[model samples]
Target: MIDHPPFALFIRGSKVDAFAVSDQLGFETGMEALAVSLFEDGPETMHVQALFETQAQAEACLDGLKFPSDMESFITQLPDEDWISKSQAGLPPVKAGRFWLYGTHDADNIPSNVPFPIEINAGLAFGTGHHGTTKGCLLIFDKLLESGFKPKRVLDLGCGAGVLAIAAAKALQQDILATDIDQDAVDVTLQNALANNVSEFVKSYQADGFDSPELKGQRFDLIFANILAKPLMGLAPDIAHALAPDGKVILSGILNEQAEMVSDAFTKKGLEVSPQPSLSGWTSLLGQKP
Candidate 1:
């Protein structure tokens, strides 16, 4: 496969707005693949990249586009190689607490004595354990497990790729309810769950945040919401109300600077935020309902 250089643009805005811009651009022809990612750290911003098969096509798209004042566009020409394979190879296996996350490419490397082994692949959704927020959540959950926290009912809100839900299933052997606003993400989660051999314990749904009928009058012993700071803040009340007494919540996908704001939102909703925070450009906070 021939590798063409990827062109990208930076936009200063929330992830929701960046996705809106991507959807608008998708309507126009010639744009093959558009990857838009929010900054891992604080200060909500987006890095949007457009992938093309040819240099001429990339230049044409870059030159013809009318960029907004807030958008900074650039083109990068990488060495000729199988970029997809190279990228996957670079991911390696990520270990957090007791959980070991590896892609199919790294399958043979996993030891038979591994604790909480999880298989994940880069697909339609996020959370392959490579992102800081995901790793942070895993570590927090491990700490909870170490402290003898036995959660019978669990919810993985915004269950991107269903990695958290899968981890819960593998570790606790309990059924999990997972949901995401995007159907593609839900699909990917299901696929990932099956790949991880936890499909029987993982139930996924596509619904707006905390608006699903399945969530009615339901409370969870533990809830994991690894979405962005804004959405996490908006879901604070729902999260607090859905938690079982003395239940814990793992919140990630936040910038270190935005951690206090998110923690305050949960705190105002009657949840006590844990001061121990993890960062990878992004931050993850652990909170519990008193």
Candidate 2:
């Protein structure tokens, strides 16, 4: 098969506007992947990058969008290269709480004191532990583990690359149900679980939200959902229903300004919600089902 270059459509604007555009592109264009990052010029500026398999698709998606007057938008074809490896090459090992997340390059340098050393390399899926949302979830979960919160049934919703599921499996030595909307992500998660030597403890499935048979009539003692804020809010009732009594939920992929809105959504579903420390302009919320 011939190799094809990926195309990226970029939008630059204020943080709020950038997030809005990101959400819009995700919902409307059906792009392969989307990311939001702080612009290099300053923290106040935000950049939204949407990746597509074809240049035509990127251009068409860009043309369909009605961006704000102040926002800037454009499309560029990336070089045909191992972009995933190139992008991940510079990422140093991230130490979140007690969990040590490292790509293969840092495998030899893992500290002796770290109990849970998870080897994850950036790939087609998300959550290599570098993103603020993923790191925040790991930090919060690590603290929970430190506090003697032993959960028997664990679920990693929107498992992405299965970093959270792998971490829980490594620390708890318990089965972790990992689910994601994309099949590629499910495959990647399972591969990562095997790479981390936790395949026996991690089960992965491709499910849209809570619709999969694997999640039917299941109640989890601990759940992690590091998805976008809008989807997180919409899934509040389902998530609340899936939690066992006194169960805990870690939520991320939310902007700092939108934290309260997401928290209120879960609160309305009878969950006692609290915000974790904001990281890199993103917010993570912890909720308990009373």
Candidate 3:
């Protein structure tokens, strides 16, 4: 497990704005590790925390960013503790549609009737199924399964903790190709799949979106891309090209306001797009290839 940094730069604002800032910090600032979380007191409010090795580095990064008037930014010294594991241990089980997502602490508390129990702890990667985007994708996938949609080939692009990939493997009993741009995410995904007893069904690799030896000349019946709106839009053509005929793609990590833009990108790629229900100011889209 990666240790938490001693200092952090925090940005607090509306969920949409905070998420945008997070993307900028991750992509532009070249920050090593960043996390976005909802404020405990205000679900609508979100914060992006970027860790740093030193107090000066944290303050310097915070000073470099141009924050909106409504957004607040500051630097703080973090406690030298395994806060990631501690926070994860306190997280309650999340039931998204038919899937029950829980950390190791809740393993014994899993209900008997839960259709899919995914054990995901907060580690070096993301996607514990607590985020709205992950939950939205899971709910949509559950609905598709209920509608008798049986996909033979599945791909989980940006497969952070491999929650969606593991879910597909568990529900369909088929092999899943899970990819992530971050090597840490790939490693965590593999570990999570093994812990869930789906390691054999989940083939994970560190690859940029849809551009890897494993994905070459491959078509998937279902693809899950729970990434940000900009990346999703940029990847529309590639995503469409990689999808098999009549294949379905679940797209999330989009704010409600950005849904139409994301939908337009997929639509231009000749994929039929339908916006799923909004969850916690986020929107998920279902795209079908012709």
Decoy 1 TM-score against native:
0.80
lDDT of candidate 3 over 189-287, digit per residue (tens) = 899999999999999998875668878889999999998899899999899999999999999999888999999999999999999999878899999
Q: Candidate 1's residue-wise lDDT over 7-115, tens digit each?
A: 4443444444553344334323335443323343244555544555566666676665554656555666555666566656757799888899998789999977778
Top-scoring candidate (TM-score): 3
- 1 or 2: which has the higher lDDT? 2
Candidate lDDT values, in order: 0.76, 0.84, 0.84
Per-residue lDDT for 169 in model 3?
94
Residue-wise C-alpha lDDT for candidate 2, range 255-284, written one tens digit per residue: 898999999999999999999998888899
Q: Give RMSD to native, each candidate.
A: 4.6, 3.4, 3.2
Candidate 3 accuracy as lDDT:
0.84
